[model samples]
Structure formats: structure tokens, C-alpha cells
Target: MLDLTSMKINDNNDNNDNGWLELALSSNKDNVKNLIEIKDRLILAYKNYENIITEYTTNPIKSTFLQERELLKSFYEKAPKNLNRNLLEQRNEHLFEQCPFCGRPCKPSILDHFLPKDLWPEFCIFPNNLVSQCDKCSTKKWSHYYSDIDNSVKFIHPKFFNLLQYIGIQIEINFPSPESIKQPDFIITFTLPRGININDKKRLSLHIKYLDIKTHIREYITENYLYWLRVSEQKRYYVPDSLNQRIKESYTGGNNNRWDVALYLAMINNDFIINHFDSIEIKKEIQDHSDIKLEILTEE
Candidate 1:
């Protein structure tokens, strides 16, 4: 995922330059001091967001904050729309290039409220809380949470958190026999960087699991494998260095931000995939990795 540097700042000649934040606060202001109150609370919520993330601590359930959050929620309930189409388009096309979450290739179809609207409608239109994602990803993220107690689960935030730097996927291929290269076995696993604690690790694992990342990757692999199989008989796929080259190209295109980018890089780097370019390699077995366990991902 890309960093949050691309999010726009205001052109309003204001020194503070909180463009999106200022617009959100003023529009929601409703000409009442309550709007000012909500803005103040929003500032605090932003503070808490920063503290919780930077300090790596649990969220404190404060009553005052909760009441303000309710007010914010009520405001959203009667708002004109969830997001401004002009803003979404401007940001998606000019600012945010792609859905950083699933690494979908283009501007997303839906504007996802990263924190579910039902749970935290106060964050409904919050810039940092709003992530541009495809319909599929937006649907999958509905009400998804690793922990019910707190919002401390530092899962992949397409807005600020970049999973590309911290997590790397590894593909392992296990053959049933040494005789043939067709229809063997494979497993995909993830590796976390050093110094990451157990709680963070578990949270990251939960993120990948619930998103059905393995399933998505497995599906792509199978489709690609089938395509290669059909072509190999005619020597199209059997041509030396083609698979690796394609993978490299995809990785280069994505700059390692997309999951498929990592996946392709993994495939190219994998010795077994290089050795046997025509195998369908269904992931029917678990591999031996201390940090990551293989799951049986199905086509269905």
C-alpha cells in the first residue's frame, strides 16, 4: 500500500491547510456551535487515532468521546451523501491511484468507510477513515474486525498502514514424485519483518485470513496455471524464461504494492516454479513454516 502523503491539502489560503478536514467540519458545521463541538471532538478523535497507532496501545472507551461520536453519527444519518462524487473522482484519479487494500488495478468502484459506518458513523466521511476500494473489497470489509473490544487491531489500512513493507509472501512447491512436473502441490505463506510483537503478528494474520487472501491468490495461480498448461503443448508456455519474465514485468508494474505483484515476484523467485512451469500445483497440503502455516485454499 502507498503512504498517506498523496491525500490533498486545502488550497483555501489558510495557513493550517487541513483542506479535507476543514471542508468536512465546516459542511457538517450546520451553523451551530454543536458543529464546532463536533469539530473539537473530531480533533480529539484524530488525536486518539494518532496516539493509539503511534503508541501501539489499546483504545480507551471514554464516555465523553462516545457521546460526541453519537452526535457525529446522527449527523451522518441525515447527510446529503456518504461521499462527494467530485472529491472521490478527483482523489481517485489524480491523488490516490488505486485501491491500496486489495491492489485492484484501477480506481475503485466504491468508497469504503474503513471503520464500518454502523459501528462508527462519526468516521463515515472522515478522510483517513474513507478508503477507495472495489465493490468486492468494500463488501468483504463490511463490519469486519479482528477484536470486538477495541479498534487496536492494526490490520492493513490502505490509507496509512502499508502492508507491503512489513509482510512478504513465500510460495513453496512440493512435488509428489521426482518423475513428473505436472499437477504437484504448492502452499503460500506470509512472513513478517523482524521486531514485530506477537499481538501485531496475530492481528496481521487475522487481516490476511478474513480477507481470503490465500483464496484470491490461489484462484489467480490456478487460472494462470491452466492458461500455461493449454499453451505449453504448443510450446508457448514451455519457452524458457517466459514465466519468470512475465512475473518480473507484473512486479515492476505494481512496484511491489499490489498483492499480485508480490505473488508474481514470489513465483519468479521460487525454484520449483522455475523448474516446472506447466504444473497446476493445487495447494492441498500444509507446508513447514514456523511463522506461516499453509491453508488449503479451494477454487470454490
Candidate 2:
């Protein structure tokens, strides 16, 4: 789990929404035309709302508002079928990766709602409240309602949190868990600044709960363990001295260290390690082993 609060929203001036609209227009032109058949119905609904709003002279009645709501809903129901698909695809492409909480490469594996759409219908379509989430961190599953605080409804928007500065990932080995007796258990805790506001803390907690990040960490660790086990087995009976001698006799540079070969093989087989290993740790580990040197695969 990574803190990813600093992902910036693109400027509204840029052709973001318009681009999506254009894409939808081009791709679903025929469908859009078909939807035009309902234009008369939408116009009728709008006219009904206008008539109620204009003719009702008494104090605004509850029924009037309800009627207006129904009218708007009906209009939308009759709208184009692909009206929002392009926007959704565009958002998926642009906001799908990078943790919304920490703005890191946790590659937001999911879409997150800063505000529960069901509880806060007004904010359902609010762009600022939508965030990309990794599997281990999101707001969808975790309920944000707090009983202790009065008038506390809003969650800390990732746009305002700048999560990279406020949060850090801590991997706890052999962490105590209720399920420990049943299987290998570990916890990846997301540490945050101690003085963070209660609402922010709750928001972060919800993000973690929704993502099931601890599960992701366990899976990652298990996969690495198996990979290392395989490598260990491959080198169980190998004599490094004899291997190096054979290589020297044959004038081949490949068999210098079976241990090194084993480690490399293990790394290659582990997807999580290949994808998310700490570069700094790798550098320090390489430095500790005088027999090996780290090589830069890409320029920063």
C-alpha cells in the first residue's frame, strides 16, 4: 500500500471533457442519432418542469420539487446511450494508475470514491472527489460514517492531502494476526503523520480497508518465498568451488558464482520483486556483497 494523495487533476482549460465528448461523438454517432428519437419526450419533460416552476404561486411545495426531480430523471433516462462511456474510458486511461492516496506507482488498481456516492448523491459525479485506487486502498468498501464526531461527513480529498509527504509504507514481518495459526501472516501498515486530523485518519483507514492491501502484501510475500525456495533447491548440492573451477577450465564466464546465479534466477521468477523491489535496498545489498556490483539498467 502506498500513500498517493498528490495526484494532480488536469486543468479544466485543457480539452479533457471536450475530448471525451468528441471521442464519443465520433465512435457512437449512429447510436447518438438513434437516441434523438427520444428528444421530443425530453423536451416535454422539461416543459412540464418549467410549467410547474412558473405557475405554482404558493410557497414552494414539496410536490413541485419532487416533480422537478422526476422530470430531470426522466430526461436523463431518455438521453443518449453512450453519453458517458467516453468520459469513463478517458478517466480510466488517465486516472487508472498511480495511487490516488500517495501519487505513486502502486498503479491505482481500482477506482475510488472520496465520498460514498450512495450517502452523498450530490458529490457522485464530482471530479475532485473521484480518485484512482490500488487494490489495497480505496473508499468504496469502507464506510466513512463516524459516530463520535458531530457534523463530520466529508472525507479528506486526495487532492488536498498530498499523500506522498504525509504517508509512508511499513512492511512488518511476522506481524501478529488472528489468522496466523492457519497460515503465513504479515502486515503492511500505512503510517501517517500522528497529528493528522481525525477525518483524514478515517479517510485513510477507509482507503486501506477498501483495497485489502494487507492481503496484497501477503500474496506478494508468499510468491517471493516460493521463488526463493525454488532457487535454494536448485543450489542445494552445488559446490561453488567446483563450479568456478569448471568455468575457469572451460574459459566460460557464466559459472563464476552459483549463489549469484541462484539469486538472479529467483529475482527473474518473482513478478512482485521484479516490479516493486526497493532500488535503494538492492543497491545496499549489492554493496554488502563484495563479489557483485549493481549495474544501472536505465538512466534516471
Candidate 3:
């Protein structure tokens, strides 16, 4: 995940109420006697959108808060055009080359609502609340998360934390017998900075499962693991550190958030992989394989 700080909000056209942001912020409808009691609540919500939402928390109101404020459905309908033109198109950079949610090399064609607009319809068009993500992240995060049950933030909000920087993911491949090498179990585990609070940790773990991020990384890690296995073998298992260095340097040019970057780093530093890559038991998996070639693995 790219750090929220990596990209800047394009607020050049925003007015005092921050234009669309106000409509979402006012959706909570604090003390209004009736829907008729307050008018222009949308403007109020937009004006206070930034201050109302925090980096670590989201509203838990069950009855679509924005609907109580006004005809929120109308705003939801028009959000895409504005989000793309006003925010995405205005940006000088594409924000990220890969989806921050999955770390795949795909364009952020879909703008995802960090908080589902269904529950918090008010934020449907809120610039800060929307994220540029791929279909995988968008489809996977299909409102299964309900932070109100535990009062914990379910995932890292790009508006709040640079999760990609403070959090780390390591992939573990449970090798099978030479015959079952194709079906190895790939386990993804996470480690966070020591200073991170427990609440954040809970959400981070939830975020991984919520998006099925590890499962997504499963195939990539296995392929890369197999590819690296082949890389070491073709070189006749000559120099361990030299080959590890080559792999590490190749992925580092991308960024801290990339999956391959983390994968190569973990494999290179892992004592077991280093000592066992050249073993006859493991090399057999590569030597006997006919599915893909080592040269092509690097191409992917």
C-alpha cells in the first residue's frame, strides 16, 4: 500500500465548505429535529468533512447516515464523474503504478470508498474517503467489515496511515513432496512496528484477511519462490549472497509497498531457503517441471 502521504489532494477548486465533502460530513444529522429542520446540510457536511473523520475511526451508524441528511442517492450517482475529473485527472502523477491494496501492476481504474457509501453514503463523493484501487481490492472489500462490533478500525485508511511503510508481510511456503510441489501451502504473515498500538495492530491483521491480500500473494510468492529456486540452480548454486543481492536490487527500484520487493527480501534473508535452494530434493521440483521456464518467471 502506498503511503497516504505519497499523494496530495487536489483541492485547488474547493471552496470554503470544500464543495462535495460537506454533503457527506453532515450525513450524521447530529441534533436536527427533522429532515426539514435543517437545509443545506450538505454544505455543512462538506465544509467539515476533514475535521469530522479521523485517521483511525469511521462512523458506525447503521441507518445510512447520508440519507437522513438529504437525497444522498443523487450525489452517489454523480460522484464518479466528479471524482475522476476533479481529483484523478487533476493530479500531476498517476498516484501509484500498482494498486496499493493488492500491489499488482494494474491501473487504479476504479475509485474505492474506504468506507462503503452504502453505510456512510455521505462520504460517497468525499475526496479523502475515496481511493484509487483495482477491481480485486474493490470486490474483496465488499462491506464485510463492521468496526462498530469491536470499535476498531477495520483497515488502514490511506487518508490516515502509511500502512505499507509501518507494516510488513512475509510469505511462508509449506513445501510438498516432489509429486505435490504444484500444491504447496502458501501462508502469509504480518509484522508491524513495535511502537504501533494494539488497536492498529488488530485492524492491520483484519485488513489483510478482509482483502484476502495474502491469498492474492500466494500464487505470486510460489511462482517467485520457484523462479528463484531455478535462478540459483541454473547458476550452479555458485554464490548465495551474490544471487540474493541481484534479486533484492531488481525489485527495490519499485517502492516499499510492492509484493515482490518484500518477497525477495524475505527469501534472501531466510536461512532455510539460502541453505536449501541447491539441495537435490528441492532442485528436483524445478528440473522436472514443464509448466513454465525460469526465464519467463522473471518476465512476470
User: Quick one: best lDDT, which candidate?
Assistant: 3
Against the reference, the lDDT scores of all candidates come to 0.54, 0.41, 0.59
Best of the candidates, TM-score: 3
Clashing pairs in 3: 21-46, 22-45, 22-46, 23-46, 24-122, 26-45
Please write out the lDDT profile of model 2 over residues 1-300, one tens digit for every residue.
223433433431124554222332334443545324444543343334323323322222232223233332332233234535533543477643345543334445455555444443222223444566655455434545332333332233445454334555544334155434224344455567578887667655654444454465456556654554444334433233333453355323332112222223434444444333344345445656876667879878
lDDT of 1 at 13: 20
Q: RMSD for each model, in Å, please? A: 13.1, 16.0, 9.9
* C-alpha RMSD (angstroms) for model 3: 9.9
Better of 2 and 3 by TM-score: 3
Model 1 vs. true fold: TM: 0.61
TM-scores of the candidates are 0.61, 0.42, 0.64
Report residue 71 deviation for candidate 3 (angstroms): 5.4
- Tell me the number of clashing residue pairs for each predicted model: 0, 12, 6
**lDDT for predicted candidate 3 compared with the true structure:** 0.59
Model 2: lDDT to the true structure? 0.41
